[model samples]
Each structure stands twice: as C-alpha cells, then as structure tokens.
Target: MCGKGQLVTDLESGEIACNKCGLVSSDRLQENRAEWRTFDSESNDRSRVGSPTSLAYHDMGLATVIGKANKDSSGRQLDPSMNSRIQRLRTWDFRTKAHSSTHRNLLHAFNELGRLKDKLSLSDAIMEKTAYVYRKAQEKRLVRGRSTSSILAAAIYAACREMQASRTLRDVANATNVKRKAISRSYRILVLELDIKVPLVDPMKCIAKIAN
Candidate 1:
C-alpha cells in the first residue's frame, strides 16, 4: 500500500530500504533505522530567490536608485534586484512630475496601491474593472497618466458610488495620502468622464475625528 513510514527489510542483502515519507536524504539513512535524523537539516542550505507573487510599491523616488541617494559608489545600497525597482520608481516619478501637483499625488497614491496589490488579492477582473474605470474617467478628464493609486482611488470611488459601498472621499484620501482638493479635482474629472453624478463625502471627510 506504500503507507507512510512503512519499513521493508531486504532478506538477501540484509540492508533495509526505508520508504519513509519525509525530506531526509536516502544517503543519510544509517544502516540501523533506529538512528533517525530530521530531513530539513539537510535542506537548510537551499534558499528561495524571488517573490513571484509579489509586487513592489516604489514610493522612494530618487532614493530608489542603488547608489543615487545614500549608497556607496558601487550602487549597492540594496540588492541587484532593487536596481530594477529603483528604475521603475524613477520612471514613474519622472512621468508624473510633469503634471499638476494633484497628478503627482495621485502617482504617489499608486505606490501605496502597489503594496496592497498582493495583500488585497485584487482579482484580475477587478483590476481590469479598475482600469476600465480609470480609462473612462480619463476620457472625461477625471484622471490620466497619474499614479495607479490616485487613479485607483477615483475608480473605487466611482465603483463604490455605483454600488453604493458608502465609503467616502475622505476615507479614500486618508488611505491614499492624497489631499482632499486633489481628490476633488480628480473626482470631478471622474464625473466628467462617466457623465454621471458621484456623491462626494465633502471636505468634512478630512476633518479630525472626535475622540472621547
């Protein structure tokens, strides 16, 4: 049946062939099965290299590059992988810097969204919906070429508005670290894009919450 830890002894050879369901190396197995060893000890040398299911939110602008900010001449502040990350961050920074302050803030907001990407487990369909909303908003001049977060905020707000999620603009602003004015402008852009009314939570959403 090949059950777990089922031991079989070779009658002719006198050596035992262990069919243990473990990570132990067959070579490490002593002649006497009584002398047991943990399999993971042998596997300690192996290591995983990359995060396939991960996405990085490059918020650190100039600080992104290897030796650009506070690193040594060799550009070895972080790891070789960080080079690509820094490059991506710088690229985004460059693209968004040309637009209005609100646009810049929106780009920064996208950085935060990048972090939540894997954590929130946003489905590809939902992400596509988010993208669709952004494109629609862009056509209306609500948002365009901004960081994904700002665009996302507007998209979610639009989606929530349609779905009546009851989530407010202030909530989006606080979560995105974007100014209310910036969000408002983008929201207006959103309204213009979709040609539909979105009930914004108003600037009061930015007011300090009372603590008892």
Candidate 2:
C-alpha cells in the first residue's frame, strides 16, 4: 500500500478505489462529472455499459463483429460444407453492416482516419473531430465519388483548423499520401455543404506548425 492514496474509480468494475494501491474504498462510484464532456463540438455518448462510444471503429465501436474462425464454440471444426456456408455468411454479414454507400464511405474513411491518427501523431480530440466532420460530409452527400483517403485527409485538415491543432493541408496530405489539391477540393466541399464554422487559427500557430 502506498502512503499517498486517493479514491479512483475502476472504470471496468465501477468501484471507487485508491489510486496508488488498487484498494476499494467505496462500493458506489459516481458517474457524474462536474461538467459534460463535449469533445470537438460533438457529444458522442452512446448509451451502453462497459462499451463506450469511440471514433476508432467505423460504427462508433458499436458494430457486432462476427469472429472469423472455421471452428465452432466447442473448438470442434464444422463440416467442410458448413464451413463454406459460414464463410459466405461472414462475408455477407460484413457487407450488411456497411451496405449503404454512405456507410461504405464511412467504413473506408474511418480506416484511413485510424492510419493518419497514428502517422500524424494526432490527439484523440482531433481524431474525434475528424470523424465527426467526415460523417457530416457523408450525410450531406459531399463525398459522393471521392477517394476515401482524400476525403478523410480533408476532414482531418478541417478538424485541425477548427480545433486550431496546428496541422495544415500539406501536413494532412503528406500523412495520408493524398494529393494536396484533392484534399483541398474535398475540404472546400465539406466547408460549404456542411456549413462548418471553423475559426481562423492564429498566424503564429501556423508559423509554429510549419517550423515543427
């Protein structure tokens, strides 16, 4: 037991405990925060215990993923014919989840979002904002036939400008391996169609971002 200890909620068990030592001090842990969390102008609170809403997944981490295994739950292999059937089911199942054109676009864009989030070393807030803007663009039919990577690069670039995260179009273009012109075009579409009101980032911030 550490001498300095404080109450820390075990997010998994919902038990309040000491931070230094994992000792439960209270049975009831309050879920109420002093203020509501609005990450990047969006409140992504899907009502589900243990599984919080996250931008990392195409379906906001809510889609049920069927495991890909030939073996059954009992660890016994299914009949070859049955395995074939299951394989088809699995493929269709994945297809069904993102059946619509908008959903399909989101799927690919989210995947690219994950890649750029890591490559650019972006924060969770930026990632969330990027996903939000992309979703809005999809809803507005702004990403009708554009490449997923290009659209996603534009969204991330807009998010950086909206949140003043110090990322430029060129930075996002390089990170996503998309052309700057494509990103800029999609970005303009996003800005106009979605009516996104992004405040101008400071000139000093731009200079600092370029220097970095």
Candidate 3:
C-alpha cells in the first residue's frame, strides 16, 4: 500500500484510488449528490428539481400535465378565446396520455395500488415490486379478460412473498376488497407465467401478525 495521501476518486467507476501506487482504496461508493448534470460552471444549477422517477406511477412520474391556471407567465389573465383554447389543450393532453388500452389499464391499476399502499401501510419497496409484477403480467397479456383489481391484488401478494413481507392473501383481499379465491387464482397465473419463485412464509411472522 502506498503511504502517499494522494487519492483520486473516480466518479464513473465509483472507486477511490491511490494516485501514487494506482491501488484502489475503496469501491462501490454511493453517490449521495442530487441527480442533476451540469456540463459547465456558468450554466444554471437545476438540482433537486423534481421527485425521482418511480414505477408506482402509471407514467413512471415523468409525464407533465398542463396547469389549470388561466394566467400567462407574467400572471396576466388570458383573453376568453385564449382561455378556451388552453382548456381544450388541457383536455386533449389528459386524453392523449391514457388513450391506449395499456395506459388506461395502468392508470386504473396504479390508482388502486396507491389506495392499497395506504390501507395496508406497505413500504415503498413492496409497492415498487408490486408495480413491476403487474407490469410484467400486463406485458404477457395475462391481464386480458381478467379482473384488473384481482390481478393487482395477486401482484401485491406475490410481491409480499418475494419481498418476505408478513402479508397474507387474506390481508390483501381485505385491503383491496377482492375475493380471496380470485386473488389466489390470479397469483397462480403470475407464478406460472412469470415463473416467479415465491419464498415460503415464516411461521413466526404469521404468529406475530396474528398477535398484533
């Protein structure tokens, strides 16, 4: 090891290396900075401007919607004609976003997911996993001719199993107001089509859940 204090941090490789001996002192360092890229110092800094992209959202939280305000950039009220045109634009924007069947499906499914997340007090990780499972099932056309709520509930249960969360099918069914049998059937479909390896539930967790 080089005794020299000269260390070079490679941001791209996430490594801290000894400049003199070319030995890496650390690896897999996490970047805690804001997700903003600026090429020049003279450029305006736009760091931490928005929420991080997430799968829990139908549009992955990246799509923007026109504001309902009828005011211009300078806060001046728009003319009646202009206001009408803006309102029409807003309606079109909203419709275009969910125009496709897949988009409409996701919009509804994610809305249900949000409600269940609060009702079940599910963690972000579990919700994200649920979203991923639901997306995969949708892609495989397993959602066609099936109840969306049932498939979503099944996805939630599958996510809980994969994530080792102490949630039962009964819990999901109660939170989602879906029939347990439907959820079970949809879960089996997910396991078969997606080939997901669900982990066995811990008896201790089940006891703990019951005790609570």
Task: Tell me which of candidates 2 and 3 scores higher on TM-score.
Answer: 3
**Predictions ranked by TM-score, top down?**
3, 2, 1
Stretches off by above 4 angstroms in model 2 are 1-48, 68-91, 203-212
Give each model a TM-score: 0.34, 0.65, 0.78
Clashes of each: 5, 0, 0
Per-residue lDDT over 1-212 for candidate 3, one digit per residue giving the tens place of the 0 to 100 score: 57975887643234678889999888744324437766568978655545677788999888898998899999999999999999999999989888999999999999999988778877676777899999999999999999999999999999889877787888999998999999999999999999999878778877977898
Best by lDDT: 3
Residue range 82-113, candidate 1, lDDT tens digits: 66787777778666554665455435544555
Off by over 4 Å in 1: 1-128, 139-149, 197-212
Ranking by lDDT: 3, 2, 1
Instruction: List all candidate RMSDs to the true structure.
Output: 18.7, 10.4, 8.9
Of 1 and 2, the candidate ranking higher by TM-score? 2
Span of ten consecutive residues with least summed lDDT in model 3: 28-37
- What lDDT would candidate 2 get against the real structure? 0.75
